[model samples]
Target: MPNLELLRIVDSIARDKNISRDQIYTDIEQAVASALRKHFNTEDTTEFTVAIDRQTGDISATRNGQAVPLTLLGRIAAQTAKQVLIQLLRQDERGSIYEEFKDRVGTIVTGTVARFDGPIMFVTVGRAECIMPRSEQIPGEEHQVGQRIQALVREVRDTPGGVRIILSRSHPDMVRRLFEREVPEVGEHTIELKALAREPGHRTKIAVSSIDSKVDAVGACVGVRGSRIKNIVDELGGEKIDIVRWNESSQIFISNALKPAEVAEVSLCFELGRATVVVAEDQLSLAIGKRGQNVRLAAKLTGWDIDILTPAEFKAGVDRLDQTLKSVPGVTQEMCDKIVALGLINVFDIEEVGAEPLVEEVGMDADLARRVVERCTEEAKVVAAEQEAKKAAQALAAAEAASAPPQRDARDEAVLAALGLTPGRDPLEKLAQAAGDDAGAEPAGNDETAKLPDPRQAVPGGAPETTVHKEQPVSSADTELSPEEQAVSLPDSGRKAGAAVEHTEETNADTAALAEGRAEPPASPGR
Candidate 1:
């Protein structure tokens, strides 16, 4: 009856903990064996086996295959067995938690806030608790104990304490998974989330596409009258979301990326992967957003370096770039016209694509290709010089205008070190420093002659044919022989093309040229 009761307890634990019955039974058996070893002080040498009968629930223990009376294990062994069983069960529970959550990483899970350990918070996720590290938490968002929340499972690991499941609210996938949860079309594979850029707790820019033509990707994600997306926004503590339509054309995609402000035109430098976005003067502030956040997020979303500008500003910048490009010496008027025709109107654009665009794509000559790349390389240095000069002029103006100091970024310090002037120091020093930088940045040789074509195997039109020959030894006797008889003494007979080798004919004297070391005449019997 006691054995049946023990079996019943095992069954109950197996069902409640979602652990296998065999696993529970095995743990119980090991616990009994462990208790026997502890009580008998034979943990190392003596072996003990414990088993439970499947049908009758009869339990038994043996020492070296011999039966041991149950009475031998007193209250002391029973207490030890119970303690061991609890420990083993806890271990099994932890193992179960790890196995359950390991595959669940990069997915959303709900949990009640369990407790806090310093900056880290613990949330009860079903059978186990997950940790939300300080870095993974949403910035400025507070959590209270017993509050239910959904978080993305960022990581799960086995640690000394047990299975540690790391949860995250700031992960980009959290928003993606939330959309998958709320928007049935996303989960149903009708609408696909293409690219996601998030500044968690601030804003998120998601590019989504639709597989079905009838289904509007952005509309479906937004739901009917913004009901579906509103739920996600609320859950994220009112963090703003921009849902952009994914397009095959990057220009269109980038145009879509800078939404809510409306883009007037997008000028793309494909080689450099940069897009100069032009917006109306009125829309400029909206396009740039507060502290350039909108443009910054748009850049992140499109994976392109974005520069926002007004129409006038863009044209002025274009004119400046075109002037800087012409500074490349060896650049002729015709070549410059061809370069503009080929869409390389700026120096950085040419530098980005290298000489390949001019030669291969635009069909420029090989010599011109090398010259163009060199010109662009030099032009880049010139542009940098002009920018530095402009910066110095601005600094001088600022010094003359007011006594207020300017704030600078820490990363700028490393760059400023090379300038020989600190941020707030003298503007006069910067003029010399800028000149020095330009001098050092110049190519080793005169920019025009510095870059030359590599040794070419295939010249334009075609390469000349090359002839191969090996040296042959001649005897002194051959040189002493008559021109006609030189062949017999030559040890080999040879004929030349287009020349008669008439044997009657004074032994075909052309052969003797070898003996005299003179040029061989053209002749052959086959002619």
Candidate 2:
């Protein structure tokens, strides 16, 4: 019965591992037979072969056509069978994990958090554990043990430890997969995902187009009442997603990429992949987003160097350049207009070309061209210096902003008031100041915080009330005390009261000795 039970276990392992039951049984037989032959030191003429009965699960081994002794299957044979089975199961499991997950990379998968190895999390997807490294995790998403999660299958690494299933929540493609998951048309290939740019956990811009002319790609991705995309947003912990229809024309595509903002015009230099997009002054804020996020995403999505300029700013730049060129002698309005027409729109451009190129392109007088170039060069230096100053100012402002102390909110101010603390004042500062003024204070050069001997604690009998004022006179009663009694510490009576106490010569001498100590100055050598 026990031996038959082993057969059932082998079948279970085969199903779990997706391994052949016959192969596993054969491996067990050979390992046992090998161990037995080695233990018995079989003769040179003998050769071993092992078999497992298909139906009965009984094992048999022969040496040169003679049956080997059953005693050959001892402790050694059991250990060998265990080693072989473990090795086979591990290898099979690795193969299954690798095969099942390798092709699934770049796709989303659901898993459960199984464990944590420092910053890396082990998420169990089916029978395999996937690795979610800290680098690939969403910024603020905290995972806990046994929590169900969904992440993109980023990579599958076959390692000596095992098959590594690496997953990611922060990959740009993960958002693409999420869209495909929620939008049926995307999954079905009716809607093609043309481009995507993402700052994970912040925002994503995706361009989608439909193969069928009748289908609205953006509308489909958005769904009716945004129901389809809402599922994805919830799954992403509310990360913002922008889906727009893709356009073949670069101008139209760029305008669509910078959404939620109205664009006045888009001029493209396809050679440099540059797009100059003009927006109304009011729409400029929306076009730039917070910290240029909208423009940055637009640039990434369209594969262009996007420059967002308000209409007024563009006009101002053009007018300023025209006026600067006219200010230079030998550079006439006609000359400036010709330069603008040639796309040499700024003084720096003219200065960089020098007089030779200017003569070749504009056919101006050689002497005049040289003067204009020299003047432009001087003006360019001033502009460069101004720009450098502006940049330095901006850098200083940014540094200040980063290092500035946070302004306290109303609640925080109220709490501080209730605690009797002023803004910018440490709560314990007054207490420390008062402590410094006390007799137990640390020594300083001044009387306050100075370490003076306290006679009250050192004396046998209670001391008489006395004043600590330096200007106060000692009384006649002080001079009557013995050298031993001088050590008694007196309580500080008010300076005003001690000022009335009369001092005799002997009393002053005794008070001096008491406060200063009895040690005499080193006896001077006989002079």
Q: Global lDDT for candidate 1?
A: 0.81
Per-prediction TM-score, please?
A: 0.70, 0.66
lDDT, residue 343, candidate 2: 45
Model 2, poorest ten-residue lDDT window?
489-498
Question: What tens digits encode model 1's per-residue C-alpha lDDT throughout 352-414?
Answer: 788876776567777867776777678778877998999999999988778765656786766
Model 1, runs deviating above 4 Å: 44-46, 320-345, 396-527
| Model 2 agreement with the true structure over 119-193: per-residue lDDT tens digits | 999999999878899999988888789899999999999999999888999999888888888899999999999
Count of backbone collisions within predicted model 1: 4
lDDT of candidates 1 onward, in order = 0.81, 0.79
Q: Once superposed on the true structure, which residue ranges of model 2 sit more than 4 Å away at CA?
A: 1-6, 41-46, 319-380, 390-527
